[model samples]
Structure formats: C-alpha cells, structure tokens
Target: MTICKGVLNSNVLFYKKLKMEVDMRDQILEILTEQRPDVDFNSETSLVTNGILESFDIVSIVAELDDTFDIEISPKELVAENFDSLDAIEAMVERLSEEE
Candidate 1:
C-alpha cells in the first residue's frame, strides 16, 4: 500500500531516521574502537572523567569525527559531556549535521 505523508508515512520516516542514527552510532563505535581497542566503549562512560581519553586522543577523535561526518566540531563544543560517551558523541554529530 502507498502511504503519503500521513501517519504511516510518518512512522516510516521515523524508522528510516532511526536506522540512519544507528548506522552513525556504529560508525562512531568503529572509530572509537580503532583508537582504543582495549577500551570497552559499549559500557564505559567515564572515558573523559576517568582520564581514559587524553588530549591527544581527543584530537584524534575530533579529526576522525570531522573526516567521517564532514562536520566541523568547534573548540567550544569540545566539552567533557560531549565526549563522555558514544551516545553523547553521536548526538553531537547528529546535531551538528542538522545544523549543516
């Protein structure tokens, strides 16, 4: 059945957006794992708080994020909360992408 921009279409769009977000999350996971294979990104949320992520690591992450998503992460956006977890990073990327 063909669904216009009605309820069913809205649900379809929602699911498509959800799948895109999940794909973005997985890409971010891959990048983080490449940076620190020993770290458990799935469960570890104190990467910045626990000093698991150093300045150099942040630089590398920023570069990778910029390259992967084609979005610029400004200096002001580089806060502990933004890089605290994979979810946070993914949200930031989605927000920035929306801005662009």
Candidate 2:
C-alpha cells in the first residue's frame, strides 16, 4: 500500500532507488555545469576529448556513480559512446538495471 508522508504519498522502501536516479542526474549536471561553465551542455555530446568533460571530470563522475547508485562502471565501459549525451547515459543506466 502507498503511504502518505506530509503532502507526499510514496513507497518508502523504494525511495532511495528512486532518489538515486534523481541524484545521479543532478550530480552529472552539476559536474558538467562546473567544468563547462561556458558550453551549452544541454545539447552537446559530452566527450572528455571534446573539452566538454575532461578526463578528471570523468573520474569524478565515476566516483559519484559508485557512491550515488551503487553502480560499478568499469574502465572498459568508459567509451565515448556512453557519454555522448544525457540520453545515452540514461539508456546505459536502464541497460545496467536490466542486467542486474
């Protein structure tokens, strides 16, 4: 059954999983926002070599991914295709979820 908390009705047990996705996207956006302060991050492909996100930023993103989502993204998975866009990243996350 759905439970109400204040003005919200959410399944408490699933909240963390839900929030993790939200937090991941926010963290990604924040990282990009800080690193590429002048670029239009919303529409471009995020590649380290493209100067959109540097290798250092990718390392930070990896750490955040592990901490925020309990997802272990390996070095082998650090392909340019994966970080091409926000849409690609979201699709990867969905694929990972299914694999688990």
Task: Using TM-score, give the best candidate's number.
Answer: 1
Local lDDT at 46 for model 2: 56
Best by lDDT: 1
Per-residue CA lDDT of model 2 for 20-97, tens digit only, reads: 777767766676566557766568875544767667777776676566556778798787777777656666665665
lDDT for 23 (candidate 1):
92
For model 2, the superposed segments whose C-alpha errors exceed 4 Å read 1-27, 34-36
TM-score of each: 0.90, 0.59
Clashing pairs in 2: none
What C-alpha RMSD separates each model from the true structure? 1.9, 5.2
Give the CA lDDT, 0 to 100, for residue 3 in model 1: 45
| Predictions in order: lDDT | 0.91, 0.66
Off by over 4 Å in 1: 1-5
Q: How high a TM-score does candidate 2 get? A: 0.59
C-alpha lDDT of candidate 1 relative to the true structure: 0.91
